[model samples]
Target: MTMVENVRNGLLIGAGPRGEEGREPWFLDPREILRTVRLRWITVLLPVLLLLGLAAAWTHLNPPQYAASTQILIDPRGLQVVKDGLTPPDQASDASLLLVDSQLRVLTSDDVLGRVVDRFDLAQDPEFQGRETLLGALKGLVARLTGRTEPPADPRLAALRILRDRTGARRLERSFVLELGVTSEDRDKAARLARGVAETYLARDAATRSDTTRRAGEAIEGRLAELRDALRKAEDKAQGFRARHNLVGTRAQLVSEQQLTQLSDQLGAARAKALEAGARLRQIEGVLAGGPSDSVNEIVQNPTITALRGQLAGVERLRADAEETLGRRHPSYQAALVQEKAVRGTIQAEIRRIAAASRNDYQAALASARTLADTLERRKADALKVGDDFVQLRELERQVEASRAVYEAFLVRARELQEQQRLDTSASRIISPASPPEKRLGPPTPVVFAAALVAGLGLGLVGSLGLELLAGRVRSRRRLEGHLGRSGLDALPRAPRGVAGAGAFRASFGTARGDGSYEVALARLRHRLAAAAPGQRPLVVLVTAADDRTGKSVLARALALSAASDRERVILVDTDPKGLVTRDLGAAAPRDLPATLRERGTLGEALITLASGLQVLPRPSDLPRDLAGRLADALLRSDADLVVVDLGLVGGNVVTERLIADERIPVLLLAVSARRGRLAAVDRALKAIGAGRRPRIVVTDVGARD
Candidate 1:
């Protein structure tokens, strides 16, 4: 009682008036994600365990499977007894991959699998038969609901399907080997099936080659018979033509060609002789016509003609002399004329005889030439007949040669086909034979369990993240800051152990707890406030929430207690009409706040100090319209260094509007365990209030979703 009275008497002492300060927009911190998972570990781990359990149950109910494997060599080049140039060579290229793939297809073809099924009699086996299963039961239930009945799977089809499902083929990397595996409930059956598929493939391949060879041989034989007949006919026709034309020489020439050559030479000689004769005849004709002549006679040699001309000239000279010396009728002139005429007549007679002999020679030469030409013409006619005979002969010989060549080629092909058929082998061969397996072929129990565990963990993490996304709640300080568009001033833990109660500020600050976590957080809040409004003493921080139940009143009290503990005077004002703060502080409600404000009543009378030395102002029933200015003045003049105004929840109400209207007054927005809907309400309120900037937000009770 004495200590309580002493405390009551002590007036509020202001150590130093503290002010608040400044601030990006929000950013994500990965540590917050880890914190979220750590806090909600139960929510994340439950699904994981359930998934793992289901996986284990499923594996246990299914029968263990055994696999048997056999290896086959896929040689790109097939084994052939004869290598012909007609067949393209197998080269190492990307095309080899196509060959390997084709082999794989053949391995799984219906022919191979059908043979295996028939050999094993798998259709009668219970394993391949349709039976009740979890999936089958579900399908049946669905079918019944849909009013449809499904027929049973065919035995042969089911067997084929099972074989295909259980078998697998994979090519060995960088090699020509292929691995074929078959899985079955019975180990021996798996081995037998694998071996059977390989044997059937080889048999089918060999049979295909043999059948192809046989067909080719039959075709070759038929073509060879036709070619032989054609060759015989061509040879017979050629022989007949040769017999008729007598073109017996193997060389492409005829005997008539030689005769033509001899006749042609004879005709050339005759023609030359005739040309010489005609020239002589033309000289004779020219002399007879008295034009000019150049001919020689046997009687008048070249020297004789020259002598005669000399004599005639001498006589003419004498006549001219006599004519000059004597009169017109002189005897010497008359004798000269007679002598010249006689000389001229003698020369003419000789020339005329030569002309007659030339004519006889030309006629004889012409007759001989005509006879030679007629003989040549008769020989040409015979040669033309021979050439006509060779035409059919040459065509028949060409046909015979072509037919023989074709017959030879076919004969060679037919022999090669026979050789190929005799030595045919499959492109692939079994290299490793399958044997019954001793252990199960599927993944080991431990490995399967580990895989299931990993998958479960992944699914659980995805599910937890999905739920968080769906709820769209701010469960961490980082998220809160992001939603508010600015970093938060402080964060409070939800129900930390050793904290006395939800709103027990005194219990939170007790020394017995060795500086409570909540108390430390409050100290940080005070530090933030001082930094936000630096150099300004007696800062008024309006504390409000987006909605009721955000624990704003408790936060306000905590802040006040923290400020006072720092040796600074702090005032807590409750302006909520709900009376949350008033009931919590155990204070009497103030009456007629509007009248008190109009008259400028004493603020000291309205103040009540708590047990923790935290001063509180009860909310008034009636507040004046100039509440922000009045409150600001009161807080500024008061002995308190900091004023924490608790306006329960910010709304469009006139009271909240008045408090947030003042720009000088720093607002502290208390966000507690807020969902997307609550933040949406806060955003609306802020917009309606027309506040250009966001207030300093403080998140409390993190991870407590509402």
Candidate 2:
């Protein structure tokens, strides 16, 4: 029989039902997924082993490559022109990173790569030039036959590409050092290429620096010429202004000091001479007046005046003698008197001459003093004019000095640039040269194998999971509810070991009332059923399963037993033709369900009340096809506060379908653990029945009953 037909037969005869069975709980059940994977062990293991083998083969075929590395110092400290305080720490660090990155780009640029290629003559190398090997030739032939375009054949480009791939440059973290590495099949070749690339880069960097410095020097020279011309013009303007103002001295003075000093001395001498001359003139006048003539030093010092005085004294003596010798009018007395008068007249003439000479001397001295005073006043006026000129002169001097200073500064900068152009080089340098590598860079044998194993296992796991999901299994209670558009009532555990029939499980269901996992699950199922049924008046619940081997019969029994234990009268009608429930309850089959449908028997005549106040109507009938309305009518009239019906194997069974089609009855769908394709089929079937009520779902175990 087909699987569905067999399941239908099993449900009727108390045989273990079969088909798609068992759904896991809503959350991911890792244990179940793992169990599924284990079930397809070969499918998982074969691919894994194959992948590992391929990895191993690849590792063996490929030759190992050696890497050679050189260390370069990226000294951008020279590029930091700003003072430390001027730049923030974060900004400085960012700039340094940018500078280092720029240098790294240059190191790997086409120019540097081309130079390395040329210097090493990499065009002749087979690896770089992509020379045709036997395998490559075959592949090319195949491509041509297949009308495929061949790859480019430029040897220089090919060499460049190869060189780029083999070379790498990276900056060491938080440091000014860079590392350059080259990989090659030949250890010595790798070292040689690495060293060659580094040297070529250094040379290029130096040449670039020299070219930059040379251009800077030329620019500085141009600026220097402009500054020099400006300085010259400033100096010339200052000089011309100085000449115009006659401000010729290095410093301005208040007066012509030397001339002023000489004139002052001359003026003092002239005043002294004038005072002496005036004193002499006064003395002469005093002597002529006959007042203290002895005090007249000038008259006493004059030889002519002294002689005249002596003669006058002698004449006076002779006159006195004559007067004594001869009485009145004697000739000797007359002659002495006349001589004394002449001497007096001569002394008067001499005194008058002296007075005239003194007046002439005083006039000459006054004239000299006046001339010295006038010259000194003229010198002071000229000195004041010179002092006024000094202000503009000093400003012009300052301009000239400033321009000169600027011009000289540019001249010094230009000279420095010239020196730099001669000796300019890059700030970076290769601190350590590459050497031949002692060890190959490829993974070791053991490590490769281990990694291959891990990778293979991962691929296998992924492939197995993919297959399991693709099997279209319902997989979880959440998915089942999603397909059915309703929530599940419960998720019950699998029956424990040695628990055989639904009858054995139900008989002992309430014995372990103390929160055993299975007992708790059944109690929850009972509670949800009560809640799902419409308000209180003898709620009739129809419990059916999508597929078989799920404990639909046992679930109904547990629900009725729970209601009975709660002091409510409950009845379980096993509508399945198999009489599985009747055997479990140890109750004889009541009357055939068709007899009751024909009104020969009542539902109460078929009811058997247990010690727990729960009643069972086992194996109601081998349902008659045309008695659908009669069976539903008899089922509804049972004598109980609650009615639980176990309709096993729902789809393709007309009797079960007829019972589920009752509008007043609520349907509870029981899902087996493996609900691969059956849950969807059951959903479609129920929809076709169109009872206008969504069935509540309950996930159940397949292999074991609960």
Candidate 3:
């Protein structure tokens, strides 16, 4: 592919999926972003409310804050003098930060606090010495009961820390505009204080610079005077030598000749250096490209040797300069021998290169120079032979003379410059003078109030919603029915005032005839049961539950009434101790359901005839422990076309397994909550009832919105 196509394809691959399906992008769902915003809205609201509430309470309980502000211009560049005419960029920043940070420390010191207390004359606030009247005692008691600790921050520290905290010094991007802001309760004081700081800092800057320049001038002056005396003596000596020897030249001409001779000597040395550099460069290039492999330990890497050679050349240049200026006897002149000896050690590994090409170059250069020097000596017979001792003395005398001349000049100039520096303060002058600001730089009042108000509104909504969430209760029929694992009869409408709450026969078949209600639902439940067992007259419909109040009583009545409407002999029975099948008809909590096993006994006679072609035997009051065996016998009886029993509370009033001793009877259980109410407890009870008691759990109530 062409470059553009290749680049496009690569980007497409990166952006698109590696496999057939791509992962979702960062922000595909706006709803998730909305959710995040909502959460953050609460977080932001919390802090705003806390700060404003405390501030408001503080104002109401105590006195109003007398606000003051000061305005000052900060040098955005944070420039400070390190030395006159030598203020480095890095040094100025370091100095400015050090000064500002130090000043901030000073503002927080005990000194400032002592000043503020003395100025304000505030030694008699009531809190300072507690006075307890009856009301005050009561209020203090209430405050203690509620665990409220509301003491104000120290006013002096409060003032300083407010500036220290809110004070912003920010430099505008790519420009020299700095923002120096401070907020205080006292507007006039804040303004004056800021201006005072600005003025004091400027004065300090000027004074410090002036003193530094004066000190530097004095130090240089002393050295300059000594150098002046030495220069005079050097001049006298030079003149004496010239007069004694009858040397013919102006003083200026003699100096120029000396400089020319020095350059001429260096020129030859520089050429020798060039030759050395070239050889080293060639050796390095050869190694850098490729060198023959070596097995011997003595063999050196040529690149390493070449680097050492460059350093040796640098030493040679210094040696040449020392020899030319010093006569051969100076310490530097003597040290040249020692340095050359070290270079020779470093060069030992490069014996091959020196043997090949550079040995001849060095010999030719050195021999040519010595021969020229000998010729110069013959030309001037009185000229000294240059040795280390002679070189030392000559160079020392020359340096002292040169330094004397330069130092005298520097002394005169520095004195003049120091005076000029003291006066040249306008360059660093305050560009914008500090003045009392017309308005304080705290956040705009309306903006702050609006932010705080919005925050409160948001927080209030969250608190309301959170409370609603925590108070979970059942509200819908579907959730309850789902928990029961059966379609519950929403057959009966809510009872009208003064009407029969039982809805009598009307609540059966999942329908209320007079109520004009969920009889429609009862009709559906009837259809489902009949369809399941078509043409089966002896169909067994067992109704039971794991726990109480799971709509088991309501379900039994509704089913029986539905089947009875279809001309089936429906006998509504209350097998639970918590309720009587007829208890609303017979009207009492059942004490037992299991002990009534006989066809003709007290349990059997408990049957009450109802108006709607149904015989209802209400449960007698008996504890569950007295009825388990009888219940097994009673359940096995085959008399009624449909027998519906009101079950007891699951895991509450009765353990179900003991009651359901007859396993042949298939069980249907009721549950009050499908998803939310404790399911594990219901499940464990069902499991205890054994596999034969196949209790189907139906939910009764669970809903998010109640």
Best by TM-score: 1
Q: For each candidate in the order shown, give its overall lDDT on alpha carbons.
A: 0.70, 0.70, 0.50
* Cα lDDT, model 3, residue 82: 26
Candidate 2: residue 197 lDDT (0-100): 86
Per-residue alpha-carbon lDDT of candidate 2 for residues 400-438, written as tens digits (9 for 90 to 100): 888888888778767776766666334688899999999
Q: List where candidate 3 sits over 4 angstroms from the true fold.
A: 1-162, 170-179, 184-200, 217-411, 425-512, 516-519, 536-540, 558-569, 580-583, 587-606, 621-641, 651-677, 685-706
lDDT-wise, the better of 2 and 3 is 2
**Tens digits of per-residue lDDT for model 1 on 527-634?**
656777887677778877776343676677667666776656778887877766666656464545555566677577677765556677887756655665777677
Native-vs-model 2 lDDT? 0.70
- Output the TM-score of candidate 3: 0.47
81-139: candidate 3 lDDT, tens digit per residue: 32335333344655666544554444334454344334443233332233346687788
Candidate 1 overall lDDT versus native: 0.70
Q: What is the lDDT of residue 467 in candidate 1?
A: 66
